[model samples]
Target: MARITHGIACSHIPVLGYAFDHGKEGEAYFKPAFDGFGWTRQFMAEEKPDVVILVYNDHASAFDMKIIPTFAIGCGELYGPADEGFGPRPVPPVEGHADLAWHIAQSLILDEFDMTIINEMEVDHGLTVPLSMMYGHVDKWPTKVIPLAVNVVTYPPPSGNRCWALGEAIARAVESFPEDLKVQVWGTGGMSHQLQGPRAGLINKEWDNRFLDRLVGDTQELRHIPHIEYLRETGSEGIEMVMWLIMRGALGKSTKALHRHYHVPVSNTALGHMVLEPVDGTVPPSPTLEGNSAAAQARIA
Candidate 1:
């Protein structure tokens, strides 16, 4: 059966993609920012995962106000790079693991977490920027990807605790799969920044680092944080941190924090990255309970 052995979290700022595409790696302004991902790239090379379950929010490219699913899973054979106004960043299309994706979709639904299944979709920077951050300029991504798009852009998005429980459902799904494969779940976005309104160009390094500390040292307490706290403390878009909880919950209850990188003023956002290898003997959720059940919540709590 497939097992999720590792978990990764990073901020997927569009400017990072721009930097990689424009060859700004060695430039004085961008060197420090780009250097933050050096260790992640080396780690990816040595780990060589077979599939990546990328959890990201679609930034008005794939889903607009017309319709948005609270949670969408891509189960297609391949996903092309979205043209986010500058012609798709000149990168190879993201390959998909349809068989595993379908299995996960079915499992999530059966676990009572509603999911919209997409046979075809184009991935925007929210999904690809993280890939570039870790893989650099490659002909194709190193491994297959299963895109999990959460509706953070839409108002009344899923709560932090709910996203965490959904992660447990995902773990149960991956564990039931018959294939012997290495899988990693990556949660992308937010370390505090507000893009518009009176609070534009915001970067709260103190809050960002505190959040990271709790995420690495005390994740159980971290999951209890509410959306209003993210909005008020981290800024309007800081709510993106909720998605990181999903990646955390997937790692069961314990982890070894391998690396942490934090930088500031990368465009309008603060960049954050961390890696986790699930500790052995961490308990997963009970398969008998519904994904959103109170008992399931306690497992994550």
Candidate 2:
């Protein structure tokens, strides 16, 4: 079966993409920010994953007010970078694993997690910026990607617990796949910052660091944090933190932290990054849970 070799979490700020594209890395203000990804890039080079299950939210670029899908999985053969206002970032298009994507979508729906299977979609900064942060400006992405877009922009987005559970469901789906692929699930967006109204430039470094601590040591407790608290304390957009739980959940209960980096004021967002691998260097075998495929098929029928 395909194994989950690593789990990564990071903030996906579009300005970071712009900075890298415009050769602003040496600038004093952006140096620390760029430095944060030094270790992550090295790690990725060493332990190359065959595929990346990228988790991010569309910033009203792809899915606007017309239709909002709580969970959308890209099953297309390829996805183009979206022109979010000022034309597309000069990044190569993302290649997708259609067979694996279709398998994951089928399993997720059967597991009762209603998902919108997307055959074609334009991926915006939320999806591509993380890729740039991870692999740098490459001729082509190092690996294929399965873009999993969550509806964080819409009010009353999926709760933290729900996102965590979905990650678990995705883990099950990935483990069931009969392949020798090395997969890594990435949860992108947020440490803490609100970019609207009078509360525009909010940043809670204390809360952000505390979150990173809990995420590394006590993830279950961190998963229980309410959305309202995140909104009230961390700032409205800070709720994006919940998405990280999905990556954590997919890594199983215990993981070894290979590298971690945290920096503040990256275009009004607290930039955070971490690389986690399964403790035993391989995912546990799929569990024979109560939900049998026959019963799942019956439910689907």
Please give the lDDT score for candidate 1: 0.87
**lDDT by residue (tens digit), candidate 2, 157-218:** 99998888788778877887888899999999897899999999899988888887776643
On the 0 to 100 scale, the lDDT of residue 146 in model 1 is: 96
**Alpha-carbon error at 248 in model 1, in Å?**
0.5
Query: Where in model 2 is the C-alpha error above 4 Å?
Result: 280-293, 296-301
Tens-place lDDT per residue, model 1, 1-301, is 7899899999999988888998998998788888988998999999999999999999988899997999999999899999888787799999999999998888787667889999988999999999999999999899999999999886798999889888888898888788999999999999899999999988889989987887664358777888888888888999998899889888887777898999888897899999988875254655566455664443332
What TM-score would every model get versus the actual structure? Answer: 0.94, 0.94
**Stretch of 10 with least lDDT, candidate 2:** 280-289
Report how far off residue 67 is in candidate 2 (Å): 0.5
lDDT of 1 at 28: 84
Clashing pairs in 1: none
